[model samples]
Target: MRAFIAAICLFLLCGNAVANSVQDSTTPADAIVKALYDNLSAAYLCRDIVDADKYLKTRSVVEATMLAFTNKQDASETILKKWEDEIQINLKYQNQNISVEECNTLLRARTHQLYVAMDTLFK
Candidate 1:
């Protein structure tokens, strides 16, 4: 359990650090960007209640994700806000706390589970 949590936290940190890259929608890197939004949504959902240390940690992750998209730096704030808003809005009906399996499933998408995991783990 500890390792899983640590892995996911590391995943988010890695994802937060890897937002930039290949620009085409058809490219693999696009999936990583989409994955980043999913994470930012999760972080945004928890930021309201998590402790300052955790919040700040997650905030840095979010910031790094933004920095990864080098070309998208123009209007970066708006883009980040829009992505967070769109993804977070979809969570309006979800439970405040998510189970590990559920989160993994929603994020991994069956065949893409490995892809997402590897992307998050080493992006």
Candidate 2:
């Protein structure tokens, strides 16, 4: 939650002009690709999401997408922070008990979903 809030704060701090520019060049496909990349990565210190090698091409796609977003570093940091908060929230809901095993299960499920999404996208 804090990470996501921080990302939003940073984005706002960066100025509206940059945000507008980013939005103008960013497509829905680019956003989808970024979301998949974010979900597949352990952006947060929460847990590891495996099966990344299965979709190696996703990295390239995500890299290209990030470049399209104006500033790559800013976009990467912002998205990572957002994913950190998102993963934490998902872990809570997906595993109310919050067990390590449950976390592993959740991450695996998320990774698999992202992989499938990537396959569909890249194909």
Candidate 3:
């Protein structure tokens, strides 16, 4: 009876640990997505071509970064920080090269791509 109780306790603890670890791993991606979504929404609302371009570019960079992190599970914090910093620097110098219509089209495509990328992650 004592052995049975100990085994049950161990099973529960292991299960909980697995659940926590999975949640912990996903949290960073979730955060990055939320931040990107907010920025994109703001750009769309403000009708800012520069912001729209920045959003599209940042989205691609972040997706690539995440993919690289997944492929190499040992991605260091410095690498992730560098990627984030690069996005910030790029956004700071956004140019209004495209017209409003072009910006809209690009942002629309980027939003759909973001959804697809996030779906794959969640799966």
Candidate 4:
């Protein structure tokens, strides 16, 4: 019984440490952006406009909410708002202007921005 309890505790601690390390390595923003891009890409590949629209709506909502909470200063807040608007507009366009190539490019940039923003906010 004692050995079993000790093993369980050890496993839990190691699991928690690994989870925390992974979370620390990637910001929530990065994960969101990556998921958005991935979903959009898969939708486009499937020629499924409905799924793409769903992802776009989800992305807009998440970005707007996150920016509202994470950015308080006027200057950056304005910038974040502008970005949120851009994302919304992108969704409204008939084309959506989201080709696989474009999505790939956007994903790269957003990933970097996510890390930077997270560092600034957390620090």
- Candidate 4 achieves a global lDDT of 0.41
lDDT of all predictions = 0.47, 0.44, 0.44, 0.41
Candidate 3 C-alpha lDDT tens digits along 1-123: 455334433332232212012343243344334434333443434346545566556545544644443443333233434444544454432544667776667656655655655555546
TM-score comparison, 2 vs 3, better candidate: 2
User: Residue 9 of candidate 3: its Cα lDDT?
Assistant: 34
Model 1 residue 61 distance off true place after TM-score fit, in angstroms: 2.1
How much is the lDDT of residue 25 in candidate 2?
20
Candidate 4 per-residue C-alpha lDDT over 1-123 given as tens digits, one digit per residue, 9 for 90 to 100: 455334433332232212112343254444433343333333333233344564455455434534444443453344334544443455443366466665555545544544555454445
Tell me the tens digit of each residue's lDDT in model 1 across 20-105.
Answer: 22453343344555455545555545544443354356445645655554324444455566665565566552346755555445
| Model 3 weakest lDDT span, ten residues long | 12-21
Q: Could you tell me the lDDT of residue 120 within candidate 1?
A: 52
3 against 4, candidate with superior lDDT: 3
RMSD of 1: 11.3
Worst 10 residues of 1 by lDDT: 12-21
Residue 84 C-alpha lDDT in model 2: 41
Q: Which portions of model 2 miss their true places by more than 4 Å? A: 1-71, 82-96
Q: Kindly give the stretch of ten consecutive residues in candidate 4 with the minimal lDDT sum.
A: 12-21
